[model samples]
Target: MATADPRLRSRAQQQQPAPVAPPPPPPPPAETTPAMGLDGSGDAPESSGTSSDDSFKLKFCTVCASNQNRSMEAHLQLATAQLPTISFGTGSLVRLPGPTINQPNVYNFNSTTYEAIHKELADQNTQLYTQNGLLNMIGRNLNIKKYPERFQDWMPGKPRLDHKGDQGYHGTESGVVDVIFTCEERCFDAVLEDLHNKGGRMNRPVHVLNVDIKDNHEEARVGGQAILDLALSLNNAASEERKARGETGWDRGSGGARQGFDEKVPEIVAAWQERWPTLPALWSLAWF
Candidate 1:
C-alpha cells in the first residue's frame, strides 16, 4: 500500500514520520564466473611479463618440433599483430628433408643460422630444395629470425638476443612469456615436460596451449591465422581481467587476483575452438 505524501500528512503524523519502504533489495552482486587455477600453490611468478605488463599483450612463445613450419608461421603472425613473441624447436637438431627418404640434412639448432642453411641447401641443389619447399621455408624464416632455437636450451629469464646482437623482434627483453602455443601435441608435451623438470621457480602462472596444425607450409599458414585469432581473444580477455582486478598485480593477500585471467582461459579457448574447428586445441596452466 502506498503511504500518504508528506505534503498531505497531519501535523502529528508528519512529526512521527511515515513508514519507509525498505530500499529495493540491493541489486544482486554481479555474476562472477571463476575459472580454476592450473595449480593451487597460491604463489605468483617472479618474472616481469608472466603476470602483467605495460601493454595489452600477454607475451607469446610458439613452439614446434622443428621450429621451421608451424611455429615460425605463428610467430610471424603474432609479431605481425605487434605482440611480443618467440619461437623454438623441440627436436635435438634442426632437420630438413634431403635427397632421399632415409637421409635428412641436419644442423645444430642453436648454432645453425637460416642464411647458412639456405646457402648450403641452395648449393646442394637449388631446384630440388625449391621443389621440396625447403628453400621457400628458409627464406621466410630468415625474415623472422636468425636461426632455429631449441626449446631445451632456452635459458629462462634471459633477454632475447638474436645472432646479430640486436634485441629480439618487438623486444622480448623481459625474458618471460605469459603464454606458450605449441603447434602440435608432441611439442606441447615437450614444453610441459621441460617446464615440469625445471620446476615452478617463477611462481607465476603461464598458460601453455596447443593448436594441432600439420607440418606443412600451407597448413602452417592457415594455423598461423587461427593462432592469431586465439591470441587476440586471449589478449582482449587479459586486458579486461586486469581491469577487473584493478591494480592488484597478480598477488593479492589471498591470491584472489589470479582468477582474473585463469578463470577466463577455458571459456575463451572453447569459444575460439568453435570458430576454428579444424584446429583442435589443448590447454594447460603451467609456470615459467
Candidate 2:
C-alpha cells in the first residue's frame, strides 16, 4: 500500500481517471504489466523519489513548417532538460513574414544560419520584425541551434555539423532520433511521405508524431511544455522497461526496451492527451 492512505487524500489529489480505452492502439501498442507494475498477487513495484528523466535520454527530432517557432521552441525545451534532440523544417524553403504579407522573406534551408537570418532581419527593419515577433522567434532559434534543417535533406546515420560550441542539446551525439514530432498536420504528412520515399535505408525504426500547434509564440510555449512532459513520460516508461529487461541501451538486435516502449506509446499519449485536449496529437511508426 502507498505510505499515505488513499482514503485520506481529497478527490482532486487522487490519480486522474484512467483514459478511455486508448484510440484503437495506433498500431497495437501493448498493455503493459499494469499501472501499478504489480504482479497477479498485488505487490506494487518498488518506489523511488528520484526522477528517471535524466537517467536515460531519448534522441528526439522536432519538425515544423519552417523550423522557426514551434519546432525550435520544442527543441529548446528538450535541450533545457538536457535531452538529446535535433530539429528540422519540412518546407521546401524557409519562409518568414516580411513587412508586407506578399513579400515574405525566404532563405535556403541548408545555407542560411539562424544567426544570419536574425541579423539580416534586425538590420532590414528591426521595429517591423520585432513587432511581428519574427526577430523574437529567430532570436530564440539562434540561441538553440545554428540553422534550419530540412527533413527532406536529412541523411540517416550522419551526425549533425556545428553541434559543438552551440547552446543546443549536447547529450549523446547521434544523427538518428528515436522520435520525430511535427508541429502541424501538413508537416506530419510531409514527414510521413518523405520517410516512405526514403524507404528505411538505415533499417532503424522510428516513431513519427504530430501535435497541432498554431504558429504563434504563446501556443508554442504551451505546446513546448507539453512536448517536454510527453518526452519525460516516454523516457520514464522506457527506463522502467529497461530495468525490467536488464537492457542498457535502446537497441540490441531484436531485444530491448524499444519494443515495450513502442507498445505502450498509445496508452502514454492517450493519457497525455487527456490533459491537453485542445492540442490534438497523432502517432505512427516509421523507419529511418
Candidate 3:
C-alpha cells in the first residue's frame, strides 16, 4: 500500500522468473501420422504382406567328411529335436579311414548300408575297430537312420552318377533348405564353394553356416548340441520377426523374404562361440 522504492520494485519485477515461456506449445502433438500427401493416404498403409508359422519353418542340412560320423551324429540329434534335416558327406568319395593310413574302407554313400560297413569292418579285423572304437561308432550309426549320402549329389545342377551309371540320391532336390550346417572346416569350404558355383542357378537363397568340430564321436555329440541350440534360437527369432510384421500362419512368401540372416543370428552366433571358446572351433555364415 505504501509507495515502494523504484529500485525495490524493479528488483521484484526481475525476480518474478520472466513468465517461463509456456513450454513451447507441447511440440504440436508429434504429428501422430506421417505426411499423407506423399503416400496419398493419411491412414497407416496396410502391411503389404504377412508371415505364417509355416513360412518360418526352416529346412536344414548337415555335412561332414564321410557323413557317417559327425554329420550323421548331427542328423540324429536334429531328428531327435524334431527339426527337419538331412546329412551329407563332403569327401570326393565316401570312405572311412581305417586304423593304418593304407587301409581305407570305401563305399558308395547312396547305396551302401551302415550295416554292411559295420560287418565288413568287424570281419576285416575285429581287433582293429574294436580297439580304436570305430566298430562302436559304426554300430551306433547303423541304428540312427538310413544310409549316408554325399553333398555333391544334393546340388541343383545335373545328377551326379555313380560308376554303375545310376542317378544320385535326390533327397535334397525335392526342395532347397534354408540353412546348411557343416561340421568341419573342409566340409564348410566345400559347401560354400558349391553354393557359390551353383546357388545363383537356384531360385531361393540359402544360408550356410560352419561350426568347426572334430570328426569324433565325442566331438560330434558336443557339436550336435551346439547346432541344435543355434537352430532353435534362429527359428524363434524368425517367428518373432514375422509376428512383429503382422504375419500369420503359412502365409506363403508374404511379409517379404527375410533380409539375409536378420540381426539376431550374429548375436546368437557370438554367444554360441563364447560357450566353446577353447575348442579350436569357428562359426561362419554365408549366403547363396
Candidate 4:
C-alpha cells in the first residue's frame, strides 16, 4: 500500500505458505502380513485356492533297472526317513541279471519274494552272488523292510501295476508322483521317452531326474543318500515357492506350480550332481 519496491513485493509473495506434500503415502499400509492359519502357521488363510487338510508330504518314486538295488535302496532310505515313496523298474518285467551275461532271473516284482530269490540264488551258486556281494546286499534289503513286496513294477505311462491295485503309496492317485529319481542314465532316458510318448494323457505333472549312479551295493548306498538329500532340497524349495505365491498348499492342478517346479529342476539337479563330480554319471532333468 505504501508503494513498496517491486523486489520487496516479490519477496512477500515468495514467503507465502507452501502446499503440504501429500502425507507421504500413509506408509504403505504397514506392509500387511501374509494370511495365517488358526494354528499360527504363516500359511495363507483358508480359501478355495487353499486347503486346511492339505498334505505337505511329497510323494516320490525311485526308478532303476529292476527296482531291486538302486531304487529299492533309495526307497528304503526314504521310508526310513518316513517319507512317502514308491519304487519302480524301467524294465517291462522285473529281471535281475546274474553275473554272467544272458543269465537274468526274471520275476514279477509284485509277487516274487526276495527271500525265495535269495535262497534260489544261494542254492544255484552261493559263491556267485556271495563273492560278488549281491547276496549281502539282498540280505540287507530284506532286513531294511518287511518284505520284497515293497518293490512295485512301474513304467512311465501306466499306473503302477502292483498286486494291491492302482493305489500307489502315500495315497497317490493313478500312481502319479511329484518326482521320480532314476539311478542310471539309461533308465533316465527311458523315463523321458515314456513321458514324451504318453505324458499328454497324464492328469498331473511329474518331474523326472537322473543321478547316474553305478548299480552296486556301495554305489546304491551313496546314491540313496544323494537321493534323500535331493528330495529334501526340492521339498524345501517347493515350500518356499508356495509361500511366495501366497499358496497355502501344493496345488497339483495348478499349471503355474508345475511350471515353477520345472523351471527350478535343472538348477537343482546340477547342484546335486556337482557334489559327486568324480562319479561317472550323466545327470539330466525333464518334466511333463
The RMSD of every model to the true structure, in order and in angstroms, is 25.5, 17.2, 29.1, 27.3
Please give, for residues 1-288, the per-residue lDDT of candidate 4 as tens digits: 111222222212100123222111111111122211112243322221211125355678888877678887777666545456777677656676575678787776656666667676676666566566556555544443323432222443445444332112444435556788888766766666655554435455666667778876667776777887777777666766666664533444355555576578667767766876754444334334
Candidate 3 Cα deviation (angstroms), residue 144: 2.9
Candidate 3 local accuracy as lDDT? Answer: 0.57
Which parts of model 3 are misplaced by more than 4 Å?
1-56, 156-173, 246-254, 279-288
Which of the two candidates, 2 or 4, achieves a greater lDDT against the reference?
2
| Cα lDDT for residue 36, candidate 3 | 21
Better of 1 and 4 by lDDT: 1
- Pairs of residues clashing in candidate 2: 30-263
Clashes of 1: 4
Q: Judging by lDDT against the true structure, name the best candidate.
A: 2
lDDT of 3 by residue, 124-234 (tens): 667666656666666556555446777767754343333221111223334456668888667766766655555455444455677878776567766766777767667
Rank by TM-score, highest first: 2, 1, 3, 4
TM-score (C-alpha) between model 2 and the true structure: 0.79
lDDT of 2 by residue, 1-288 (tens): 012211223212100222232211112112211111101122212222223344866678999988888898787666666667888998889988987789999999978987788777776777676567776567556656678889889886776655774444565355778888889888877887777677777667787878899988778777877887787787788778888886754653135677888788888889989977999998877777
- TM-score, prediction 4: 0.65
**Between candidates 1 and 3, the lDDT winner:** 1
